[model samples]
Target: MTDDSIYHVDGDLVPASEATVSVDDRGFRYGDAAFETMRAYGGTIFAWGDHLERLERTCEALSLAHGLDASDLRTRIDETLAANDLADASIRLSITRGVQPGKLTPQPEVDPTVVVYANPLPRGGLEGESVWDGPATVETVETRRVPDEALPAAAKTHNYLNGTLARAELEGDADEALMCDREGRLAEGATSNLWFVRDGEVHTPTTDGPVLPGITRRIVLELALEAGVPVREGRYEPADVLAADEAFLTNRTWELRPIATIDGHEIGGGPITARLSRLYDERVEHACYR
Candidate 1:
């Protein structure tokens, strides 16, 4: 973000330096909020509908009725991007249960706080370059993902302590951390979804587990199926990934990042990974740059 960057706060566009949420806001006080990380290509937000659906699901999980329509949020995101003069960018949209009496229980009536912000990034398409420097070096962390029964894995909420602690275990030794569930089954990365290829099959941890159902992960699975590639989603162990022929990670920003190594073991991108990457790029081009 630049000095002149703009942010949309509660329907108003404000300078990044001046944008403020009340100290008493529930999102600040108790991590009571929902958000989505998105990417824009050629001035258009890719998978806008998908992101909106997930955001709505997250808010529903928190029982937060924001009382704002999709158009309102979309306009805010568009305005923020235009204000920042960014065509290709990374975007974040947050909706927090607004200020109420200081208590654990939220009020039925709500005055939600909404915020939208963006940072410029390289254009994404068939001709685009990756945001990542290179394939990520990941290490399996001892920190386990919070079980879905404890906290619904589908909700993209403000509480990210699980990922924070998992990443902290890295101690700068690796670019990412792979977290497992309480049963020692592979879940996901601190921020991205994990993927591995073995014997011409693409495999990832099932979303039914503690894994996040990532937007990019969904797209890759669809693309792989549409392209006639075998894909599987099930509980997996670290050893399963370690023995794979190829590996990668997925997120809104990273798109599909090849995994260079896991725990110092060399398991890099392969033909399948490259093919899926190209397909992802083509999807971006068709969606935004066409």
Candidate 2:
């Protein structure tokens, strides 16, 4: 693709090369930043408020400085979309501890470095159920998810080395890996949330307990509720997943997916996920597709 036209950061429309961060920033030096990936369609961002809320929550949990209030952030993002001439696109925003070179001592009072980059969103429907594979759910597991004590699993911080390590186990067989907490209860995926549909109820792990509270997961819950589906969140064993009638994963990039396997057997996204995925498509398609 041609070089990305200048994207927006903070307030300026700057060239990608000029969108720089100090080498000493904690986010760069120690991966001390937090980020959120969001998608925009039809000139409007999907779940803009929810994504902002989550970002704010992550910053609050880390006690990190939030450079701009939510309104300011939204206006900036809207400006970014206009600058990019976008109808559909993906946005990645990251903020790190400000420029302070080398040295181990952590500093907290400085301004956070914020960078926003926009790119074409994936075409989507690459595998939403009827679009691809035989079934939507697939098996994936590694060492259980990193426990909450090890690192805040709820925050979308730069510290994902544990998730990275877990995904190493997903390389060969599963489309994604189900990470468990140290206690071995279902945590979430290396990149998404795990949902099990059994006897018509939708079960996903609780965010306050474990797993990143994905923006998409929250939206799904609301949509499911509006559609009269019962959704529950709790601690689930991967072993429990094996007994489920259907399983699926949800992420901003993937939306809703049905699982056909967990560790080996044919555990699928079940009828619940299929109905849910269709509902999601019908709802989001209006918001995301012009």
Q: How many residue pairs clash per model?
A: 0, 11
lDDT of each residue in 1-290, candidate 2, tens digit only: 22766666556778777776667778878887778988776666888878877887788877777567777777777777777776567788777776764776656675777777777664443222333345443445557776677777768988878768877776455677777777778888888888888888889999877688888898899889999999999888877778888888888877787777777778765567878888877776666564
Candidate 1 per-residue C-alpha lDDT over 1-290 given as tens digits, one digit per residue, 9 for 90 to 100 = 45778999998999988999999999999989999999999999999999999999999989999899998899999999989989999999999998989999999889999999999899899999889899999999999999998889999998999999989999565889999999999999999999999999999999989888999999999999999999999999899999999999999999999999999999999999999999999999999998
**Pairing residues by index, what is the TM-score of model 2?**
0.86
TM-score of each: 0.98, 0.86
lDDT values for all models:
0.94, 0.74
- Clash pairs detected, candidate 1: none
Clashes of 1: 0
- Candidate whose lDDT is highest: 1
User: Where is the poorest 10-residue window by lDDT in model 1?
Assistant: 166-175
Report the Cα lDDT for candidate 1.
0.94
